[model samples]
Target: MSTRFSGKVAVVTGAAQGILRGVALGIAQEGGQVLLVDRAEFIHEVAAELPQGRGTGFIADLETYAGAHAAMARAMQLHGRIDLLINGVGGAIRMRPFAEFEAAQIDAEIRRSLMPTLYGCHAVLPHMLQQGRGTIVNVSSNATRGIRRVPYSAAKGGVNALTTALAMEYGEQGIRVVATAPGGTQAPPRRVPRNAEGDSAQEQAWMQEAVQQVTGSNFFKRYGTLEEQIAPILFIASDEASYITGAVLPVAGGDNG
Candidate 1:
C-alpha cells in the first residue's frame, strides 16, 4: 500500500519459490521495478505475476561468484541502477546432527546457506558505492542459534556477521546492510523438493528432531506466516528503516537474537 519504492529497481534472489515469492510480490506492489533471480525457469512465471508487471527474470546459480556477478550486471544493464537487493537465496538444505553429516553434506549446507549471500553482497558493493547509496537485506534464520543443521547455523551466523560488518563499513557512503533472522515459517510446500534426506528412518528422526527444536525454541510454538517473516525484511529495505543498519532483526515471535 505504501509506494515507498516507487521508481526504484529491486533485485530479489530466490524469487522462484516459497516465502520469497511473497517477498518479491510485496516489492513489486510497493512500486519497485522487480527483477527476480533464481535457478528455476519458473522464476519467469513469478515475474509475470507482479502488478503492472513486465517481469525481468534472471536465471542464475547464486552459489557461484560468477552467477552473483552476472545477475547484478545483467540487472544493471536492464534497469540502469539497483536501488535495493534482497539476498534470499540461502536456506537449510539438509537437517542432521553435526557428527552424522557427511563431508559433502557439510559443504553443501555451507554453500546453500552462506555463499549466495556472500557472493551477492560482494558482487553488488562496488556498484552501490559508485551510485552513492543502496540497501541490502539478507535472509538469515533463527536456526543460527538452534538446530541439527550445524553447518547451516554456522553459515547463517556468517551472514549475520557479513550484514553488520558491511553496514558499519559502508554506512558513511550511504549504503545500508541488514538481515532478518526469521523463525520457522509457514512456507508453501516446495515446488521442487529441496534435498530429499528424510527417506531413511534415522534421517527422518533427525529431521523431526530439528523441526521440534525450532518450534519449541519459539514462544509461539508455531511457524510465522509468510507476511510475518518477510515484512521486517522489506521494512529494512525501505526508507522507513533508513537509520537501521548493522543489525539483524529477529522476526521470530520473541527470539531476541
Candidate 2:
C-alpha cells in the first residue's frame, strides 16, 4: 500500500470492528498513527492487533457531544495534531417500515445513526481549524434511497447535508469534508451487533424486504465487500484527492444513493 498517511495522525470512530476496524488498519499500514475509538472495550483489542505503537484505543460513547469531545481531546493530547478523522459511528439499529416504528424507536434510530457524526464533526472542527488543514470522511449508506428503514435513511441524509455544508464553510480554512454512501457490505460477523434482540418472524420479513430493495437498486445486485467500501473513503481522506471536497461518493455498484 501507499504511505499516503505517512506522518499523519488519524482518529477512527466505531473502530472496534467492521469497516472502522478495516479503516484503522489500513491507516496504520500506510504509516499513519491511528487512535481507535468506540464504546466497546474490545476497541483496545483491535488497537493491540495493529503494528506496535501504530495504534491506540479510546473508548467513548460518541453519540453524545461530551464523549465526542473527549475522544478528540485525547487524540490531540497524544499526537499534538490530528490530520484525518474517519467518522464511522453509525448503523441502523432496527429495520422496519416507517409506520411500524414507534415514536421512541424513530428517535432511537436517529440518535444511533446521526448524533455521532454530528457531534464528531463539531468536536473535531476546532482542532482542525487551529491546524488549518484536515480531512474528514463520514460513512453513509445508499439505503437513503431504498428500503423499509426510513429513520436510518433520514439520518444518513443528514450526514450527506452535513458533509456538504461543512466543506463549504471550512474549505477556506483548509478542512475537507467528504462522505461515502456505501451499499450493503459483506464483513465478518459483528463482534457487537447493532441490535442485541433477536428478530421476530415479521421483523425478519421486513428486513428481507429492505435487503431486496437495496440489492435490486444496485446494478450488480449484490453487496460490496469491506475493502470496496474502504478504498473510496481512504482516497477521499488522502492528499491524492486533495481537490475533492463537499462530495459524497457512492460505493454501491451503480446505486448513487
Best by TM-score: 2
lDDT of 1: 0.87
Regions of model 2 farther than 4 Å from truth: none
Clashing pairs in 2: none
For candidate 2, write residues 73-180 as lDDT tens digits: 999999999999999989998888898899998998899899999999999999999999999999988878977789999999999999999999999999999999
Candidate 1 residue lDDT tens string, 1-257: 69978888998999998777888898888888888999998998888888866358889999999999999999899988898999998777777789988899899989988999999999999889999999999999877788678999999999999999999999999999998999888877887677865457877788889778878888988879998977787788899999899999989887644
Provide the global lDDT of candidate 2 against the true structure. 0.92
Name the lDDT value of residue 15 in candidate 1.
93
lDDT (C-alpha) at residue 99 in model 2: 89
In candidate 2 the C-alpha lDDT for residue 28 amounts to: 94
Instruction: State in Å the error of residue 165, model 2.
Output: 0.4
- The candidate scoring highest on lDDT is 2
